[model samples]
Target: MLKVLFAGTPDVAVPSLRTLAADTGHFEVVAVLTRPDAPTGRGRKLMPSPVKQAALELGIPVIESDPSEESFVSCLKATGAEAAAVVAYGKILKEHVLDALPLGWYNLHFSLLPDWRGAAPVQRAIWAGDSVTGATVFRITKGMDCGPILAQSTVTIGAHETAGELLERLADDGSHLLAASLEAMAEGRIVPVEQPQGAFEVARKITVEDAHLRFDVPVFAVNRQARACTPNPGAWCELHADGDANGEPTTLHVLAARPIADDDRDNFATMLANRAGNGDADGTSASSLNPGELLVTKRKVWVGTVTDPLELEQVKPQGKKAMKAADWARGARLAPTAYVK
Candidate 1:
């Protein structure tokens, strides 16, 4: 069996660690390296990372030290591990640490090699409207996720899948890929392939500003943005009551949304306008609702976009729990002309 050290931190990394530990015939997980305990929850209690908790359960020695420290390499070498496997370890490993192992360190990244190579590949892929994405196990290099590839597996992105949902699936699927790659390396059956030279998009970490919804864009774009930010820094917009532009704007969190079909856009707009007593005789003049305009009805709440309107299925008003969009609109008692920005 190939003695290996495992490095990971988040819950997503737990599956990969478990997979390698269970495959005792080919690999031995000598120890696990993870981030130190972090303050969590309302009480701010220091808690062990998911990886650390798992290592304790598996009876593996745990190391929670900074990789950038000068002594880290020696510490790793002391574990009697010939190689290392990393998954969301959440730190930049220096050259000396990367070279400490005889077989070298391999990283399982949640994107195809040379594409979306950065901190937030899964989130970026969904935000940028990627139709397909995959996981790649690569030999760790000095560059950020720019390592040579060892194994890869692809999956289709669902139209309405949230970033959190897609990441959960990728984590599970990639666990098997990661375990197999390590096995291949142990048997000398895998060769690292250098990444192709090309312009590639970076998946930088998502910020709170990135999660702000732009109603001025097309409905499809708005839909994508909402889905991409779901369950994270969460897509949000400023709710402005009619004739209250100078008042404090309420933050509205968009939990779920769907674009109005092209064929139904005109009818929906006309119906809303008529209900608000703002439509002309033929209703054609009121068919074009301004972007960011709100059309709240008895059952649903729709927000206008550049192309068409989007139906908000769930939303969270400032200082309130998540609820159905229609219910929130009713309780808020917003004016007919009130809209979100």
Candidate 2:
């Protein structure tokens, strides 16, 4: 059995921990190092990490620390770890920490190397509109996600799939891949391929500003933004009134939508809604409304984007709780040609 130290945080890392723990005799996970407790939910009580919870159940020593490179090195030295496995560890690792491990350290990243390198690769890949993405297990190096790959597996990014959904699939697949990769390393059957050099894209962490939608751009770009931001800081845009007419202010959420073929527009301004597409009971209707215009049907609220109008399935007003867009429109002051921000 190999002596190992596992460092990780969040649900993404839990699957790896489970595999290592369950395979008792084959591997001895000496200790689990995770981020210190964080406040969660409405009451703001501090909570233990997923890794910590699993480690406790298995009777493994658990170390909770702030995810700093220095702190990680200190923890490793205490354990005299022969090897280390990291998954979504959150903290950036330093050269000394990587060097200290007797057999060295490895990371299981959510995307293929040199493509979406850095924190939040999966989300960034979708945001960039890439159709294909995968998981990679590589030797941890000084640079961010710049390491020699030990093994990898790919998966398709469906058009309407959410980031959360993609992550769930990847996590389940990657855990087994990690076990096999580690198994190979133990038997000296796997070879580490050095990463290729060149101009590769890096995944910048998503921020609040990234969520703002630009209606002036094409609907395809809008669609890309929406797909990229699914199940999190979602892609959003304003549904302004058509030519400053009667009504109060309102906005809509493009919860679920698809791009119509002929709605392409070099100029987002000229794009108009024609007799409506599919918006359903959540404030969408079949009506000949201009682009960026809004229609209230059956007391529901729908808005036309730079492309065709989308059915606003979910919506929320400024300083209000999120709810069905139609319900919100009905309660708030809303009417035809209502401007949204």
Candidate 3:
């Protein structure tokens, strides 16, 4: 069995750990390293990561630490590990950590390297509207995710999958890559390929300001942005009243959505307004309000935009439980030209 050390935190790391432990007789994970328990949620309770929970369940010891080289490397070396694997560890591996292992450390990154190389990968790919994404096992060089590739596997993004859904799927993609790579390593046959240098783009971390949506932007663009932030730093749109009345804008969380339907789509093919046609069934008014603004609301919610309208199938309106947009319309306190900013 290979004497291995594992370092990672978050749900992203859970899959690899589970895979290794499930097959423990082949690849023995000697120790697990993760970030310290952190203050989470509004209550600020100290919470363990999914990785920590899983490791403890399996009777594995976990070391929580900061990004400092000595702090990370010393704990790692104590495991006397032959190889190390990292996934979403939230720390940069310094040169000493890489050299400390007999076999260099490897990282399982969410995106195809040389592409989405920074903080968020699955979200970035979907936000950018790329139809393809994959997992990359690479040699952990001293830079960012700019390491050479050891193995990779690609998967398709469905037409209406949110970022959270995609990441859940890619967790399996990452599992397949890691297991195959480790098996090859056990047989002394795996080879590392260098990452191509140049023209790399940074996947900036999502900030609170990133949640704000501008209605003036194209419909498709805004749609992509919303779903990318789903289930986390959620993509949010604000509503301003047609008349005076409000304390804080109406916050809408985009959950489930699809492109405009055929009937509405045909209407949008020319001009995406007035399709619902003068108060269809619900109290919502219909007219070509400016794109990025609400157009109709009867059984469903439709937001008009420059290219096409978006049908919000599922969402959570401000201060309300998550419910179908259609259901919310019956009692919604909104009026015509209520805009989503």
Candidate 4:
């Protein structure tokens, strides 16, 4: 059996660690390296990383600390490990640490790379409206995710998939690829493929600004933002009362949404034009409603955009529980001409 050291953190890395630990016929996981325990949850109690918990359960020695530390290198050297595998380890390894392993280190990154060659690739792919993304097992080099490929597997993105959902699928798929890459390396049947020189996209880390939703853009773009940001910083838009003396705007967290169909969108435009020209049956000036105007009825809540109006399916208001958009709109008593910022 080939002895190996495993380094990873987070739930996404758990599947890979489990596969490597369970399959001891060809590989023996000598030890696990992960981030130190950090506070989590409401009580702020220290919590072990997912990889650390998994390793402990598997009866493997676990080290939770910075891998660049000299003491860490000394401990790794004493493990008699021939190789190391990394999956979302969350830290860049120094040259000295890489030299500690006899066969160097391999990483299982969640992207087809060369493209989306940074953090938050899966989320960025969805935000960019990409139809496909995949996992890549590569030889770790000095560059970030710019390493030579060892194995790859692709998966189609769903039309309305959220970042969290896509990551769950990719993590499962990546675990298998990581296993295969390790097996190939052990059998001497693997060759690293250098990434080609060309234009590629970088998936920069997500920021708070990325979650702010703007209604002046196309419905598809807004939908993409909602899907990409759900279950994280979360997509949100500011709602103004049109004439609030205090100038306070309510922030609405958009959890889920769908772009209207072309035909339906055309019909909605016609209806809005008529309402703008003539007072609506409810004696409200729908015509004065701007592109960012919000409408609420018994069934749903709608927001106007550049192309078509987007239906707000799920939303969360400040200091309130998540509820249907219509319910929140009704409770707020939004007027027909009320426009969101």
lDDT of 3 by residue, 143-246 (tens): 88887788998989877788889988888779768877877876789877888878877788877578676556666787788778887787777766453346
Q: What are the Cα lDDT values of the candidates? A: 0.89, 0.71, 0.77, 0.83
Kindly indicate the candidate among 2 and 4 with the higher lDDT: 4
> For each predicted model, how many residue pairs clash, with residues at least 3 apart or on different chains?
0, 5, 1, 1
| Residue range with the least summed lDDT across 10 consecutive positions in model 1 | 280-289
Best by lDDT: 1
**Candidate 2 — which residues are off by over 4 angstroms?**
66-74, 237-257, 260-291, 299-302, 316-322
Pairs that collide, model 4: 276-287
What is the C-alpha lDDT profile of model 4 across 60-108, one tens digit per residue?
Answer: 9988768767688888888889999998899998888878787889999
Candidate 2 clashes between residue pairs 3 or more apart in a chain or in different chains: 272-291, 279-311, 283-300, 283-301, 283-302
Model 1: clashing residue pairs?
none
TM-score per candidate, chains pooled: 0.94, 0.81, 0.89, 0.90
Distance from true location, Cα of 129 in model 2, Å? 1.6
Sort order, TM-score high to low: 1, 4, 3, 2
Q: Highest TM-score: which candidate?
A: 1
lDDT agreement of model 1 with the native: 0.89
Q: Mind sharing the TM-score for model 2?
A: 0.81
Clashing pairs in 3: 213-341
Candidate 2 on 135-178: residue-level lDDT in tens?
A: 99999988788889999999999876767789888988998888
